[model samples]
Target: MPLTKGRLLLAALIACALSSCQTADKPPQPRFTSTSKDAGSATTTKVATSRYFIEFRSRYALSYGHTYVVFGKLDKNGNMISPEVAGLAPASHDPSQYVVGHFIPVPASTGWTDGDLEEQYRSASWRVLLSEAEYRDVVAFIRKQQAVSKTWEATVNNCNAWTGEIARHMGYKTPGIWLRPQQFITQLRQMNTTG
Candidate 1:
């Protein structure tokens, strides 16, 4: 082979090596590769252990004493659910199917609407921090509740009841304070000393 050809090949190899080194210095982005199986495609998500908060809310000002609770993962900046939404529509605007004057345990994530929460939430928060194992345990508890029975009562068996059950299962205390959503969840928070 000619000397010039050999030199060109060596230069190309050096450039490639330097470029690869540069790329390795940057952090890799999370990638989702989808695969088609049968008639549908599925994308597997990276299941990193996440922390969740049991957001406790209070009764709305004009809601005639109503409250609720929900679970949410802490965001990248450590933000959990907030019950505050300024100037939201009234509870009577588009009454929540699961929250308004009723007592039923709905899935925390998709149970109520934003307006429903803002209209009813007075001012309180009960956040239960969860490890990965605790998160799974809490999830199973929720699933069992979902599979069983669901009944709603006017002021008796309501969303606070749902959160109370969750609090007990999560190894917290529920000292029979079932009516006031605000106070009940505050007790749960006080009991969540470990997680």
Candidate 2:
């Protein structure tokens, strides 16, 4: 039986419409296939340690102008996990200044006119006055500073890296203050060597 032209046109249009509707109803397929083998890329990891040197002093009324220095280990999380620190005292006849309660380094030659025995006695007198109470506060503050310092370094902006740590950790959040690592190292070295 030969189909009429009108009937054939109607059948073709219905087939086309059904095919388009079926295609439209289907869900999207994923681009990649499942694989049992893992890719063999090895992960590289790095560990960090925080090292610190400390000096603390006060010249307020009724208090002697005394200074002390302590060096200790710090953990990966920037905590001072060690309870004990190596104590140090200044060289006798060395004249130096303390910046905001931290001692600054002086020239080695300035320590004494003569490496005289008497000068040694004087330097030895500048011993660390460590007590359990003061030690707790000092260590706690240092640990706080260490954690914040690393976080600030990750910022990587020249000004932010320098100033951000001090401002945030020290609670001096006013903008534009720069604190370089070298400056910190110098202060710590001075304190460690001085007292």
Candidate 3:
């Protein structure tokens, strides 16, 4: 059949319009589906409504027989931010031997210059040794607490009334300890620049 240019153009437009209309009127399709028979089956999954902050601890050894713990942060303020824990030990080598416990503050003037083994031992007042397994447990504890404190307000819901409570609850001591505000902020800045 012979067709005019106008007729062909009109047919094309009509077909396009009909296809778009059909698509627009169709029902919405689900993106995900469960194969399980039970609605509450173990395989069935639901998206979590809440999220948590996270901290990481890399393994490190101390001068003495103790494992050093260094704190790190993974999530904060709806962003995935990983920051190292400054001025702390990461893991101990011989935790059992260092019964005095771990924690020896190095003087800024000293500049980490404990040259001799004897000198380092003398300077290290506390004797706390941590095995690799114990150190892992501590790191896990820190991560768990970080997850719990999603918001500053929720953290303040506790008595400490501070954003660092999550870190503290995991085993933070006094000034300049793990996850202190100044130290954490410093580490965060370092991480940002390094990346």
Q: Best by lDDT, which number?
A: 1
Each candidate's lDDT (Cα)? 0.44, 0.27, 0.27
- Native-to-model Cα distance after best TM-score fit, residue 122 in candidate 1, in Å: 4.8
Name the TM-score of candidate 3: 0.21
lDDT of 1 at 54: 46
- Cα RMSDs of all predictions? 25.8, 31.8, 27.9
Clashes of 1: 1
lDDT tens string, model 2, 1-195? 356887887676556433422321112111111110111211122112223322221111111112222334445643334433211212233233211112223221111122222222122111122234444555565455434332111112222233234223332222321222223222322333321
TM-score for each candidate, following the candidate numbering: 0.50, 0.20, 0.21
**Residue 76 deviation, candidate 3, in Å?**
31
Task: List ranges where model 3 is wrong by over 4 Å.
Answer: 1-130, 153-172, 175-180, 183-195
- Global lDDT for candidate 1? 0.44
lDDT of 1 by residue, 94-129 (tens): 457434334333323314534345433444554444
In model 2, residue pairs whose N, Cα or C atoms come closer than 3 Å (at least 3 residues apart or on different chains), thus clashing, are 88-195, 89-194, 89-195, 90-194, 90-195
Question: Distance (Å) between predicted and true CA of 171, model 1?
Answer: 1.1
lDDT of prediction 3: 0.27
How far off is residue 155 in model 1, in Å? 5.0
Best by TM-score: 1
Q: Which lDDT tens digits does candidate 3 get at residues 1-195?
A: 457887897677556433422311112111111111121222112322212222211111242121122322223232223422322221233444222222221111100112212222221111112334544565565555444433211111211222234334434332222232223333322332221
